[model samples]
Target: MPTNGWDTHMHVTDPSYPEAADAEYTPGQHNLSDALSFESTIGINSLVLIQPSIYGNDNTLLLNALTKLGTRHGRGVVGFDTDATSFETLQAWHQLGVRGVRLNIKSNEVNLTEAELQERVTRYAKIIQPLDWVLELYIGMEDIPKLEPVVADLGVRLSIAHFGAPTLPPIGNRTLPLDPYTVAGFQSLVNLLKAGKTYIKFSGAYRFDKDPQYRGIEGIARELLKFAGDRIIFASDWPHTRFEGLDIHPFVEKCLDWTDAAGVTEKVFSRNAHELWDIPLDK
Candidate 1:
């Protein structure tokens, strides 16, 4: 942990909670106890509880966790009906330490056409813009071209999940296949970073190329670091969804090594996250 540093992305899910009826999987009653204990033991002082997909639009678990963790130590990004959520609800959540809204496409059971999804996201962004809350996206890098323009026009800050999850082309014949779609999407992300229109999480390493040492994600991480050092933040993805019981110490070490650039590790692990999530802590 980075002492009073922040973990910008993590979740609080329990089996006792009401999961979405059509959820793909049921998370065991793993609430904030483990995460809180782990963070305390490791010296991390704050967290941003990202709503997991297993609960769909239900934010009960997330909200309760935030309350328990207290505003000073916890903030959250919750899932809600973008179209139907009331302004009062937004205000209330903000008062209770919610700082962002999530638009998760990965692991979502509900299917909507591209246009419909974009429309809802736009609406949600508009709703939260007045509160100065961010829109956290779990979509692929390929969708950036289509989505970025819409969000840019909306005038809301964006935070992308999982290192943008670049779709790397297959390596064959001792040659790298730089797929145009993936390449373009990634470039668009870089453009967004340079423009200060978006931020990204240096998280979910397990979701990317599963080379045990996480060597495959280096290129993307290095690229983002070059464009925006403070815009990149770190997370443990604890409880390590789907891949439970993961020892995150190695991943933490990897984060430090990969961000070995002067002062970059501090920014990624602490300063940047505090700014992004508005953790109530001193500079």
Candidate 2:
């Protein structure tokens, strides 16, 4: 772990908060203490608490965690009803270390038509423009091609979770055909990277590969590095809801190994996050 790095994505669930009635899956309870403990063990000192789909628009748990961690050690990204959330509410959250909003499309089971998707992204982008915060999406690889045009020139930063959460084609019974070129919407994703308004998170390898170590996915990272290593951000994807029991120790090493070879380990692991999220640790 980068001792001064930020885990830009992760979630903490408290059972006291009511779960969304239609939550895709309830996460096993992971407290703020537990999250801090694990990250400390790995040598990571900062965190970003992402609002899990199960929490819907309720951010009580998230706010409490942020209050405890404060801006010096924590920042947050929340999920909200775009229509219902007020500017005052967002401003309040901003003061408490909330730096972004997320569309839980993948986990919340959103199936917007291409036009609907475009409109939605536009709304979110426009809402956060004044706040200088990012608009994050939990969409899949296939959605990237559809998402690129809408986000390309939005003038606000959009961060994609889990390397686009790409589901690559299987090569054979024993081999993984994990090439980004073989994946849908990859070029569109790269196009947005080049356009300079997007950030790609190095996280959720388990979503791309079922292997515990997430083997054979370096092609995706290398290609991402090739196009925009400086824009890449590393995250722990902590407690790893939906994909439990994953040994992330080696997986993180693999990401570093690749970034080191590309000569952007510092950028990906530290500098990019400090810039994109405006984390204030160094100051």
Candidate 3:
């Protein structure tokens, strides 16, 4: 198949970094060359390399890869300390096709006080606002309520990572495991969609459920699709972290399956991504 789709989430490992050893999940022996090969196989022409927790704020590896790919094959979603990164630095990154920054509150294994988190997000908004970059949040499901006001206050485009990072058991329920809190959070996503302030990537199903077939996981994905079809974007989470054992193709296929059901494959797989990230699509 000819590659034409855009993968909104993936990580490329930089062996040169000493921190690679500490990674609980690292992309398997795959460099940018390997990633391009895999993307070719899956019919993915472009990808967004998210900053993995292992790399922390050291984005040298991701930056180097983007430099090599030169924005044709790759773009980046980087992580940085707002205190450390200057607005001019963010502007330079944007010129290189970085349209968003990753905030990994959950995987970084650090809990922030509500005030501290707010301060950090607020500072980031100040820097990123001028560049028109969105904030991509990787946080736990329970944290969404606290995050709502931060997102509202910042007023930058927001993208939630990994289906709001719901707890594994409810995801494992294999039926529509509905809880009041989860229902409320799902509704919040709908509201964000309606307001045109947020987008959610349908990736990381493996993190949500161990079953590769993703039995019960489909229900949650379907519900999210129902809430916001065009606002949804599909991703492979390729070389799927912590679950490298699973084939990348199946992950992409499952996302396609959910998009098909939602009747938003065109937008989710291609259109919305281009519009959001400013990547060019084949006409």
What TM-score goes with each of the models?
Answer: 0.90, 0.94, 0.88
How does candidate 1 fare on TM-score? 0.90
248: Cα error in model 1, Å: 2.0
- Model 1 accuracy (lDDT, Cα): 0.78
Clashing pairs in 2: none
Q: Best to worst by lDDT, what's the order?
A: 2, 1, 3
Ranked candidates, highest TM-score first = 2, 1, 3
Clashing pairs in 1: 15-29
Worst lDDT run of 10 residues, candidate 1, spans 172-181
- lDDT of every predicted structure (CA atoms): 0.78, 0.83, 0.74
Q: Tens digits of per-residue lDDT for model 3 on 1-283?
A: 2245788888888555657444555445767887788888778768888888888778887888888888876779898877677778888888787888888887756688778777877887777887778888887766666666667668688888887776645543534443323443555556666677788887786776677677655666777777578777777777677677577677677877778777888888888777777687752
Report the C-alpha lDDT of model 2 over 1-283, residue by residue, as the tens digit.
5557788898998666688888877678799999998887767878889999888889889999999999988889998888899999999999999999998788766788888888888888889989999999898778878876677567689889988887765534325435668777788888888988889999988776766555546678888898698789999899899876667888888988989889998888888988888786482
- Tens-digit lDDT track of model 1 for 1-283: 4556788888888877777876788776677887888776556868889999888888998898899988888889998886678889989999999999998876563456668767877888788889989899887777666675576676788889988766654332212222333454887787778778688998887775566666667667766777589799888777788888777787778888878854588888888877777764573
Residue pairs clashing in model 3 are 3-43, 174-216
Worst 10 residues of 2 by lDDT: 169-178
Q: Report the Cα lDDT for residue 22, model 2.
A: 81
